[model samples]
Target: MVVTTELVGLIHMTTRPFHNLLLPRIAVLLVLGALPSCAEPAAPVHGGAGTSPTQKSRPPEKRPDSSYRPPRGFTELQSVAGRVARASGHKIVWRLQPGANPGPLVRIRGTVNDCTIFVHPLAARKVPPNTWAFLFGHEFAHLTENLGTHSATSPENELQADITGARYAMAAGYRIEAFLGWVLTEPDQKSDSHGSLHQRVRAIARKFGVPWRTIERESKRAASYRAGR
Candidate 1:
């Protein structure tokens, strides 16, 4: 007969003359065991490829003042965003959020919140007309895909957005290839949020029917120019 320690303990406890006295205490302990421990925070819920922690962490650090205004070319970007939304068949609503303004007419990237596309002031001010159009096209494509706040790290979703954006840009007479070349050459910064540059460039090229060799050549040239080599 196998007498496991647990069974032995149970037998011993049951045979004890004091077992009735321990019953109330044992019941209390059992009830207490059912309660959850408060030592740690509950895990955050995620839906599909939602925004990463790194991307979410940026907002508080980069938050602008209440009175902060969007940079120049706001009107132009708004117009382009509207056009791209219509072209992409999403018709997403647009809103400009506060943030530091830097780079050309485009610098920061826009994000989707619900059915609305939120553009940062820096993004609005830095990019050229074509880049601006392409960016909005990409964001609006997210809406068309019904991907709400999906993580940019999702390669499939990101590529889909890029393909849709590229088509919209080309239709609107924007130089999407040039924008893609610039993107491909830029140093890797947001890998957790957007995945690898090579993957992105390849996906965009494949989807848009652009020759990968041309994009690769252009990216290398752009990189060399930036490096002053």
Candidate 2:
């Protein structure tokens, strides 16, 4: 009987009640640890151990104005038009015909359907014969590419035309860079989606490294021809 009673007493001790107050302390020990000798967390092995790649390194932002634009010329732009027109593959035909208003001060760069390239003169002094030729070639390329239809808003295409302008002038044996310096201009409000003036100017200038003095000397070709020179 004594052995049986002792067994019961041990069972009672093993089944003793757990107080609510003891749980918090146990939880704290499990979380924080009771031992004061716990080592400090080891320093990170590498500086970028846990960061996302994007968070670790940011990409560069683009500036809207980071484009090219050449300076404005003093003389009327029509002068360059004459020279450009004279140099184009297809002869650029010009005539003083007043018509229904199409758009603002924008030039009609190429012939729409007609085989012979033509640009409507804004005024008699509009784009002189020479300047219009190169512009005509540019427009002709555009017409060929169907730019007026498919990629009208694309900035890159217009830039290609700018390059074409300088190229045509060079092919005509004129000083390409000087004419480009004058010809590289803005599209006014109509050209919002186009690249800025500086970028266009630079693209042309980079292509035609023709000397500056050549441009100045040939400046008079605005109203006159220099052997398509």
Candidate 3:
């Protein structure tokens, strides 16, 4: 994916320290297969670790800003996000933006204490709930594992997130196969930060103790079926 000037500017802004406060790591989910380094500022919120419980307690949902009208499928996105958050035991604030730019499908802001996930309206309408679970799971893994502040390489951070995120998705009862299927449709190219599609798929499969070849076969079939339709 081509990084626009606006995104570059935003990235620069996020990296700068503001008021001597610790900046939250901004994890961007690139739909077209690029990844950016994390650097952003936001307040704090408490989060938990480990897999989600079989039965989860519903947390109080935060209402969106009244000034902006929600896009189509926003409600469904909220529902799915809530489930993922509960499964991860994290309190997240969700926002929907009107821009349909081909930059990031989701932008995570804020530290562990005050985290907000910004989703583009286009992603809300177009991506499936199960896929969103994996995306959310990946970001939450970053937050929970403190991958942003660690000295690990970018690819290492991303691979770790993929493994932990798959666990979170499973705990939330979302189908892992759905996420694998979606990955099949994404560009297989690698970036300076994110791994190639194959690497991510293998990491996630290992998390579930699934054979790489099995997932590869199944995912291709699923992708083919969707394409044929």
Best by TM-score: 3
Q: Highest lDDT: give the candidate number.
A: 3
**Global fold similarity of model 1 (TM-score):** 0.52
How far off is residue 102 in model 1, in Å?
A: 9.8
**What residue pairs are clashing in model 1?**
49-151, 104-126, 105-125, 105-126, 105-127, 106-126, 106-127
Q: How well does each candidate superpose onto the true structure, as a TM-score? A: 0.52, 0.41, 0.60
Tell me the spans in candidate 1 whose CA falls farther than 4 Å from its real position.
1-72, 97-116, 148-153, 189-193, 216-229
* Model 3: CA > 4 A from native: 1-72, 91-100, 149-153, 221-229
Q: Over 4 Å off in model 2, which ranges?
A: 1-122, 126-128, 148-151, 184-192, 211-229
In candidate 1 the C-alpha lDDT for residue 78 amounts to: 61
**Whole-model lDDT, model 3:** 0.52
Put down candidate 2 lDDT per residue, 157-202, tens digits, no spaces.
6667657654665675544544443343222122444555545555
CA lDDT for candidate 2: 0.38
Question: On a 0 to 100 scale, what is the lDDT of residue 64 in model 2?
Answer: 12
Clashes of each: 7, 23, 5
